[model samples]
Target: MTKPKRFHPFYIVVEFFNVIKYWVIPLALSLVKDELSFSWWQYGMFAILFCLFVFDIIRWRMETYTLTGKTIHVNEGVFTRKVKSIPFSKIQNCNQRTPFLYKVVGVTQLKLDTGMDGDDDTITFHVITIAEARRIQQLIQTKSDSLETKEQQEVEPSVITKEERTLHFSPTAKDLFRASFTSLSMFVVIPILLSLYSKLDELKEIVPIQWVEDQAQSFIVQQTWIMMIVLLIIMVCISFVVGIIRTFLKYGKYEVSSDKTHVYIIQGLLNESSFSIEKKRVQAIVIKQPFLKRLFRIAEVKLISAGGIDHSEAKDDINSLFPFLPRKDAEAMISTILPEYQVISTMHSLPRRSLWYKLSIPSYSWILSTAIIAGLVIWVPALQPYTWLLYGVSAFILLLSVLRKILAYGNTQYVMNGSYIQMKHGGFGTELFLTKRTKVIDVSVERGPIQKWFDLATIVTSNRGKPVLHRFRLSGVPIPLADTFFTWYRERDQEISIVNEDQKK
Candidate 1:
């Protein structure tokens, strides 16, 4: 009913920095304008920066937000003039972020998500006081609570009453250190190194290639082993530093807690964020352990929700209840957050015949490739050296692939509990997926000629999201087991329908 509020004036500085990030070339040009042949480039840079600066200032000035009893409104645009009104009941998540700089200034950012896939439907407050942020959060929670009460009253009186329960969790210093040691970000650094190596042609413009080659030759001849060791140490050190920095920014001071209806997570060192999600909306819980994480006995737990939000989008930690926790602790956390879901069950491993079933395609392909390479080497004289190298490399790769397939088959397992079903499998990085049978939208069982011989089938589970349909797959499962799984899920579906009808009365 009243007028909307604006951000703090200090936000102009924030906008200024944001705009400046895009002016790297412009800034460099300004410093050397007198030495450059094209004076126009310098002026052009200034014009671009000036335009963006003015646009950012106007955009920040025009943006305003308002909250009413039932709806929240946001008005923002430079030329198009967009307006959004989001009802409190439609909001699925409430999150807050505080960058290190913003924290120092006692300001934070608040975001409201409507469970829509695109960010266009979301509401964001760029810069607001911490007090205001907390007040707004309380307002949203109050509305959700009122709506839940009304919905409960509308349902039949015989509906079971769920008691309120709460669980709080935070990582210890020791756990954080172990997480840092197992960080997979080091692999990300490999690509950066390769990219730099690939840009040697670009570097030639500044430093002569001949000089680089000569330096390399001399270093290799004089101190090959010493330099190799030093380089290895340096790369390891750099990777560790980068990994630690990234880990801290994402998970420092992390905390999570869940109640009967909602789960809340808060984390980050440099850019802190808080995420809250309803418990009932979760479609599945996935426990992930990459090689390093598995070796360290830690796992990452994430949720698959029917809502449009994927794990890949915005603050992925929002989907993850435990980014880095001991395997047992992670399972305990999942059980606490989702009481109806349990992690422990008798797992049925895939049949021994499933190994050949899994490896059939890869094995045939490798054999065909090896034959082709052998033929080429026997006929072509020039390709002899390269051909032998290729053959050896291919053989090694085939061996590795076979090993991976065998391990994956051995690790694969599935189980059927009363209300829940779980599938666990992976090549190197493993995933354990658990979901209620009622949440599974569809089930498909596939059998090729080979699978039919082995009496094996691959069962795929479909839920309500893009690209996650086949995520919960039990590959190389025996036909009988697959049939049993299908029957159990179908019965659970019917039971859920009957319960819904009973509640309607």
Candidate 2:
């Protein structure tokens, strides 16, 4: 633990790709120059790449990280030297990712993060062996526990260290099948197929694009009903199979567990990723039921912490409890992971009068479309015969807008129990956001002209998200309830101050 260390030697390769992504397209096009000798720009490119590699070597020599008894120290700078030391007690989350490339090298990247300044919030070891990563984890755990014991001794001299980990949830094969279907991963293949189809003309020298298109049309788009039906069935089967493979690869070996202090998650079959977050660092809990998940009566639960999970794989959103789970399963996970917060089922719905106010809000889309249709009919006399048709389209769109508002009104709800507040709102699908009073940074009540007539108001609360502030709005809340929300948040001042004092201690 006393020895100084640097990143794995592969960092030179990493730096090349970092700059290559920007130059790859130009470089690829340059290859088509058909020049016998290298062009001047090509020479310049090689020189740039060579200089980049040399600088990376210099970087590899200069940067060194040391693991000490109480803190991690990193010293690295090109021109001017800089030093950073982070106490293990301040660490909030840790994640280890072994991407395909890293797996090939038998190494992984480790990230330790805190809830502090963005620049100094995270320290990452871009390349380290798995054993070294595990050793660092153990050090952080032991050091943080000892620090916690000191804090307890400040009040009443007692040490409590319980390292019992319990398995909370793991997806079964059936669960994976359901997740694959609900994820709509089949659509991923369609986009790939369409991309290849669009680019087929580029391969005209080898493949006949027109002939392929004609064949595709004859069997598909410009075909009889029976042929079209058969093609659709084939597509469905292929998409389903693709979705299953994708789901199994990504969600396979997924496990969720927790100890006395942290929630742990490890997933992926090949490109494995594991994340751990302290229970107290969680800022909020979001229960999302998208259109597809809602259809299956399932939801995805996400824990919003200051030191968030990997942001690059945004679709999977690594902080999520499980990308696919039933409502009951997510609820139970919430209770088990963060028992201080509760996921309530029913809340106060919007009163009938709120519907009138919502509907009264003018539809900009309807107005804009109606004007376009009118202009089209007037300018093009050829369209006079189809004026009724244009009007029907406009009416249908307006009807859809009205239907959406009705659905929104029916879904909107709000409730506050003690120190926790939950808000549910959306049209086609619902999102229930729950957070404690101290977690809410801001709260406001808006009573617009229409809302005033109905004695209704919109209550908005803001919380700390991964790297952005997340705001949730609950429309159609009674004015009296809005006052209650504001008051409840205001009461958090004393509690927040106590937490600050504890952290200072």
Q: Best candidate per lDDT, number?
A: 2
lDDT of 1 by residue, 246-327 (tens): 7766777788877667888888887888877777667788899998788878899987765434446564556577577899
Candidate 1 structure lDDT: 0.77
TM-score of each: 0.80, 0.87
RMSD of each: 5.1, 3.7
Clashing pairs in 1: none
Off by over 4 Å in 2: 21-37, 80-82, 151-162, 198-233, 309-315, 378-386, 497-505
- Reference-based lDDT, residue 246, model 2: 89
